[model samples]
Target: MEDFRKKLYEDIIIKQISRNNDVETAHKCIETLSRVVNNIIDSPNDERKRRLKEKSKTFQSNICGAQGGVEFLVKIGFRAKVIDFEKFYVLEHPLTDNPDSPEMEKLKVAQEILQDFLKKVKDRAELASKMQAKEKAAEELRRKAVLEKIDEDKERRVAARERLQARRKSQEEQETTINEESNSADDSADTADTTDTQSQPEQFYRAYHSSHYRQPNQKQD
Candidate 1:
C-alpha cells in the first residue's frame, strides 16, 4: 500500500509540477495540504473538536483525480495538447468516474485507513493530560494532610513534656519538707540524752554525803 502511494506521489504528483508550478512549490503545496488533512483527521466529531475529514476527502479526491493535467498527459504520453489542459482540467477535478486509475483507489483507501488511528491518538492525548492533572491534585492534598499531622504530634509532645516537668517539681518540694522534719527530730533527741546523763551523777553525790552523819559535826562546832 505504501509502495503504491510512493509510486503515485513520484509519478503523478512529481510529474505534474512544471515551470509554472516549480517542484519546490509542489512540495510545499503537498506538504501543506497533507498537514491540513491530518489536522482534520486528528479532530473528532466530539463537542470539544470539530471533524472535517469527509469534506477534505472529497476535495482531495477531486484534486488527485484532476492531477493538475497529469492524468491525460499520462493518457497520451507527451501527445497532450495545451488545449487538453484548458478543457480537461475541469474533468479531472470532477472525475468522470474512471475506475482504471489505481492511484485514485490508493489515495482513497489511505485516507479511510488513517481515520481511526488519528482519532484514537487525539483522544488518548486528551485523556492522558486529564489523568495527570487529577494525580497532581491528589498528591497536593496528601502532602497537606501529612504536614498537619506532624504539627499536631509535635504540639502533643510538647504539652506532655511540660506536664511531666510540673509534676517532678511538685514532688521535689514535698521531699524537701520531709527531710527537714526528720533533721529537727534528731536534734531534739540528742539534747534530751545529754541532760539526763548530767543530772544522774549529781544526784548520786548528794545521797552519799547525806548518809555520812552530818548532825554530829554540827553539834561539835
Candidate 2:
C-alpha cells in the first residue's frame, strides 16, 4: 500500500509540474504542501491544522487550483466534506511523529522532493536572469558602436568640407593677386605713353623756331 501511494503521489507531482509550466506557481504549491505536511506531523491533535477550507484563497490559489494539490492531500488522509454548503477537506486521522510508519515516511519523502524541486527552480531562475542581463549588455554595446560610427562619419564630412572651402579661398586669393599685378602693368604703360607725347610736342616747337629764324647765315632755296 505504501509503495502504491508513493507511485500515485509521484504521478501527481509530474502532472503538477507539467500542467503549471510556471516555476513560481509550482514553487508555491510545493511549499504549501510541505507546510501542510509539517503541520500535521508537528501537531497531530490540532484540529485546525487538519482542516482546510476549499473556498479559501490560500487553498484555491495554492492547492485547489494546482493540479496535484487536492490529490496529494487526499492521499495523505484528507476527505472532502460539506458543512452548511461550504466545502472543506478534513483529515480525520492526522499524521503522527512515527518515524517507521508509512504515512510519516511518505511525508518525509515528499518534503525531500519538494526541497530538491525548490532548489532546482531557484537555480534555473538565477541562470535565466543572468542570460537576460548578458543579452541586454550586448545590445547596449552594439548601439554604442553604431552611434560612434555615425559621429565619426559626421566628423569626416565636416573636415572634407573645410578642406574644400580652404582650397577655394586659396584659388580666389591667387586670382586677386594676378589681377592686381596686371592692373599695375597697365598703369605703367599709360604713364610712359604720356611722357613720350609731351617730349614730341617740345621737339616740334624747337624745330619750327629753328627753320624760321632771322639773323642766321643760311642758304635760301
Clash pairs, model 2 backbone? none
* lDDT for each residue of candidate 2 in 116-192, tens digit (9 for 90 to 100): 76677677767877988999999999999999999999999999999999999999999999999999999999999
Error of 2 at 218 (Å): 34
TM-score of each: 0.42, 0.58
* Cα lDDT tens digits for candidate 1, 46-134: 22122122224433443343344334223312122234233222112222234445534543543443344334434655676788799
lDDT at 134, model 2: 99
Model 2 off-target regions past 4 Å? 5-9, 18-20, 64-66, 83-85, 143-221
**Local accuracy by lDDT, each model:** 0.47, 0.78
lDDT score at residue 29, model 2, on the 0-100 scale: 79
